[model samples]
Target: MLKIKNLHASIDDNGVLKSILKGINLEIKAGEVHAIMGPNGSGKSTLASVVAGKEEFEVTKGTVLFNDEDIEDLAAEERAHKGIFLSFQYPVEIPGVSVTNFMKTAINETRKAKGLEEMPAKEMLKLIREKSELLEIDRKFLSRSLNEGFSGGEKKRNEIFQMAMLEPKLAILDETDSGLDIDALRIVANGVNKLKSKDNAVLVITHYQRLLEYIVPDFVHVLLDGRIVKSGGKELAHELEEKGYDWIKEEVNA
Candidate 1:
């Protein structure tokens, strides 16, 4: 449901722009899961941010199309409203906002954007209960402030819970497995797998292949030096795990 072509993005460093993503071309159709595996500073997350419309990165070239429309000019919130959800590597802490309260506001705001009335209190409550239970999130946990004092697993699980509630067409998970324990990873991956459907797509960006053991990707792409130098099937991830990115770099440079 998402297509990116020849995307080049850069971040400004004290008034000078430093290039990050260079010539990234990818297509994620509905009902597929795609993984982006890369080493440090390879612009894996940059592609996710650019597609999510993060303002810090400027897209100097190429186009990002969601479904069939160009969203390169849209703001982050606008892209979110259009069914693009990005799970951050580091989810920010909101001191006083309970998870339940935050979800209520987000859902209603999206509804408002679609010219629909607020969800009835009863329906909203049902949704919260269902999604929390789907992600195995405790109701008591939901009562706590969002991401405040949460363990790495709790934070990542909470992000998946949010994704469950939002039900985006394309879900971009940017290093959700970072710092998560094995059990936590399993839980988060289970939640993501359960949420997968023929109507939605998932893009997982990570440095390790372990996460793929759970939420298996239909395709894997290797990003090197800000460009996707190689694209292959799920087996490619295993190859990368066995042989580091050096071999891919060599192949690309050859």
Candidate 2:
């Protein structure tokens, strides 16, 4: 559902253009889950941001095509309106706004963008209950402030909860596994798996294979130095786990 071709991007650091993603080429078909593994400063998150149409980063070359249309000129919210969901690495906390209210506003905004009337209150409540239960979230949790005082797992799960509610066609999870304990990780991954289907795609950017153990991607891609250096089946994740990225770096430099 998403295709990226020779994508080069850079960020302005105090007015100097610092290149990050260089010549990134990838394609994610519908119903497939893809994992991107890379070391620090390897442009993993950059790739995610560029795809989500973040404003800070500029695309110097190439194109990001969603379904069949190029999305280079689309703003972040417009891209979101088009069913591109990006889960942030660090989700912001809104202390005064309750989770339920926040989600209600967000859903309504997206609907308004689509020229649709607001969803009925009854339907919204039903959806909230179903999605929270699907992720094993307590109703009490929903009444609390959004991401406020939430544990790492709670924050990640809340993002997944939003994902469930929005039902985006392409969900880009940027390091969703960060700071999660094993049990928390399982819950998050389980929620993700439950949401997967024949029409949606997930792009998981992570540093470890443990996340893959739970999500079980169809393809494992090793990204190094702003480019995807290797691609393989799920077993490649295990190999990276056992051997670390050193071997891949060695091979790349050889």
Candidate 3:
């Protein structure tokens, strides 16, 4: 459902171009979960942001194809409207906008883009309640400003709740396990597992294997120095956990 061919990206102005993704080649099929693990500055988050069309980064080369269309040229909102959902590592707080209002606007905008009729308020509210319940979020949480005054766990749960509501085709979760305790991790993983379907895919970018034990990816890849140096099955995560990334670095430099 998603493909990246020889993808390369850089940051800052043209003068400060330092390529973070060096010829990345990846494919994520529907009904699958792919995990990307890497050390600090390995470009895991940069890849996610570039795929989501974040404006700060620039693609120096290569292409990103969503479905059959090339999405490298699309704007971030356009990519989102096309069933691309990104759960940021740092959830942004909107001080005045209630979560309910924010979600409603996002859902409606997506629907309108797909030529679907707007959902009646009652129907939307019902769906939101059901999803919120599944995430164990109180209705009052919906009335609060988005991420404002929310604990770290609360922010992550809220991200999953929004994902459940949007139901995007491809969900890119960037460091979803960061700052989460075991209980909160289980809750978040359960929500993601429940949302998985035959027609959707998830790309989980994490620094550790702990989250993989819960969410269980179909494939695992190790990225180093801005490129994927190794790709393997779920067991690769176990190996990394046991031996650490130094083994991989040794192998790379061998």
Candidate 4:
């Protein structure tokens, strides 16, 4: 459902344009989970942000297409309206806004963008309850302020909860496994797996293979120095886990 072609991007660092993503070519069809594994500064998150239309980075070359349409010029909000959901590495907490209320507003706004009316209160409440239960979230947790003072696990789970409610066609999870305990990681991955469908896709960007154990990927890609250096199936994750990225780096240099 998403295609990126020779995508080149750079970020301004202290007034100097430093390249990050250099000629990244990837295609993710519907009903597939693609895992991007790389070391620090390999441009994994950069790919996610550029795809989601973050303006901080400049796309000097290449194109990003969603459902066969060019999205390079689309703003971040517009991309989101087109069913692109990005789970941030560090989710910001909005104080004074309860999670329930925040989700209500967000869903309504997305509906409005699609020329639809506000969801009925009853339907919204029902969806909230159902999705919360799907994520094994306590109802009382929904009443807490959005992400405010939440532990790392809670924040990540909340991100997935929002994903469930929004039901985006393409969900890009950037470093979602960071800071999560084994149990928290399982719960989050389980929620993601339950929500996956033949009509949607997931792109998981992570540093380690542990997350892949729960959210098994259809494809495993190793990104290095702003480019995807290798691509393989799920077994690649185990290989990387046992050998670490050093072998991959050696292969790249060789």
Please, what is the whole-model Cα lDDT of each candidate in the order they appear? 0.94, 0.94, 0.95, 0.95
lDDT of 4 by residue, 1-254 (tens): 99999999999999999999999999999999999999998999999999999999999999999999999889998899899999999999999999999999999998998999999999999999999998899999999999999999999999999999999999999999998999889999999999999999999999899999999999999999999999999999999999999999999999
lDDT of 1 by residue, 1-254 (tens): 89899999999999999999889899999999999999999998888889998899999999999999999878899999999999999999999999999999999999999999999999989999999888888899999999999998899999999999999999999999998999889989999999999999999999999999999999999999998989899999999999999998988889
Model 2 misplacement above 4 A:
none
Residue 169 displacement in candidate 3 (angstroms): 0.5
lDDT of 2 by residue, 80-155 (tens): 9999998889999999999999999989999999999999999999999999998889999999999989988889
lDDT (Cα, 0-100) at 55 in candidate 2: 91
lDDT of 2 at 135: 86
Span of ten consecutive residues with least summed lDDT in model 2 = 179-188
Deviation of model 3 at 97, angstroms? 0.4
* Candidate 3 error regions (>4 Å): none
How well is each residue in 1-254 modelled by candidate 3, as lDDT tens digits?
99999999999856877778998999999999999999999999999999999989989899999998999889999999989999989999999999999999999988898899998999999999999998999999999999999999999999999999999999999999998999999999999999999999999999999999999999999999988999999999999999999999999999
Clashing residue pairs found in predicted model 2: none
RMSD, every candidate, angstroms? 0.7, 0.8, 1.0, 0.8
lDDT of 3: 0.95
